[model samples]
Target: MKRLYHWPLDPAGRLVRLALGERGEAFETLESPPWSPHPDISRLAHGAVAPAIVDLKTEPRMFACGTRAICEHLAETGDGTALLPESAADRAEARRLWAWVEAACEEVTDTLLTERVMQWVRRDRQPDSARLRRGAHALRGRLTFMNGMVEINGYLAGRQVSLADLAAAAHLSAYDYFGDVEWDAVPDLKEWYARLKSRPSFRPLLADRLKAVRPVAHYADLDF
Candidate 1:
């Protein structure tokens, strides 16, 4: 069986899981926290990243990491739900949107997570409140920009849902758990997000619990 090394709380990992489930592919799941330096994951992969995959039947079990690359690989290696569009133009557009989402998540989303949510996960010195504040501010700015992009006929990557939806929703869902997202400020995005969150694959993500974290009722509420 194909194996996926991952963390339940990770936005990037969640993106991969959502794609995998949406495509109806089967794989084993492992919880590997990104910040941990211990000897975790498998020796075959030679990496401890939350999205590293291994195909046991292969000589070199290591497959790939990173959200977009793995999603494309899975879509190619399986049946149903063709994630990568067939046309060169559509593929280029998909990749472009994927790249933008990755940059935004790393530069904005993960910064907020490391401060607000992931702080409790580590036995670190302290959570940088100033950086958290900065990330919160950055998130508002990015949300404003993204909300505008999404307003033009819906979905972040364009008309049809694509990796862009998975990427954006994963980050927003993580922040939502921390009460970081001001949903009213972006009602269109919020409505779209509510639909995404209601999907079967996403319920696991919404239901996942972490100590000291209490998600709002609206987190699981399909409406609003």
Candidate 2:
């Protein structure tokens, strides 16, 4: 059995989940929020966090930490939908864009998503206006870039869905969960997201709900 430890809204974890879904792999999950690290995660590896996985059926109990390690491991081993493209050039492009998505959204996650969790889930204090503004500005730039990519390639990396599309979708889904995305501003990207959102792989993410905060009204609406 494969056991995945992950936080629901973490883009890395979401990406891994989407990959697993696309590959038709079944695995149980344990929620491991980064803010308050789960004790069991430390047993896997020092400083291990969500998005980690352990293959309980393996001889030595194989384990992988982080998205790059886990997702790539799945890509290499799985028999279902190919996350990486077939051709070498397309594979390289997929990987490049996959890495790019994580990098590009780092600032937005660190600022906007973090603030949302703090303000809503934790309810510790008021959110910082400066951080929210900074993240919003960064998100807008990313949306523009992604919009252009889809406009040119039909998908993030190419004609078919790849890890790049999954990666981009994961991050954007998190932002949309908190009602941060300006979908109307990016028409092409909005259409692309709608298609991805309609997929079975995306259903688990759309169903995610926090006890403290509800997702935006249109979050689970396929046609929206």
Candidate 3:
């Protein structure tokens, strides 16, 4: 049996889940919040952060962290999903696109999420309207670049689906839950998302609910 210690609402954790779905891998999911940061958190050097996995076959007791590392491990041992392309040129392109989304998407999405989403999850850190507004404004600039890519090609990385698509979807889906996405701005993006959200694996993520915040109806609509 394999176990994944994860936070249900974490975008980074969702990255790993998407990879698992891509590989058609099955593993137990455990809700592992930082109840006590003293021993379990990375700052404490105990277990890994959320979405950490333990493979009972080899090292059931030990755990692994880091999104790419975990997904790469699954791809190697499981169904060998063509996530990172083998061709040098393709791999380089894929890596480049993945990095671009990582640099901007998470920060931008987190800016909105931390303000509207995570703030509700944790009441201690008060939301800052000024910073959140700034992040939201700056994030729109990335939309221009993303719109261009979507317009030129069907997918975020290239013509076909790849980790880049999953990565970007994971970030944006969090916002979609809050009705924050301006779908009209990027029809290409909207079309691509329509297809992405249509997938079976995506359904569970879309259906995911946070007790503190209920997602918008469109968030679960595959057609939307």
lDDT scores in order:
0.75, 0.93, 0.73
lDDT of 2 by residue, 57-119 (tens): 988999999989998998999688999999999999999999999999999999998998899
Residue 189, candidate 1: how far off, in angstroms? Answer: 0.7
Give candidate 1 regions above 4 Å deviation: 37-42, 45-48, 57-62, 123-125
Q: Candidate 1 local accuracy as lDDT?
A: 0.75
**TM per model?**
0.88, 0.98, 0.87
lDDT of 2: 0.93
Give per-residue CA lDDT, model 3, range 149-198, as digits (tens): 87777877677777777878887887677787888888888888898888
Candidate 3 Cα misplacement greater than 4 A, ranges:
34-47, 60-62
Off by over 4 Å in 2: none
Name the better of 1 and 2 by TM-score: 2
Which candidate do you rate higher for TM-score, 1 or 3? 1
Residue 208 shift from truth in candidate 3, angstroms: 0.7
Tell me the RMSD of model 1 versus the true structure: 2.3
Q: Which wins on TM-score, candidate 2 or candidate 3?
A: 2
| Residue pair clashes in candidate 2 | none
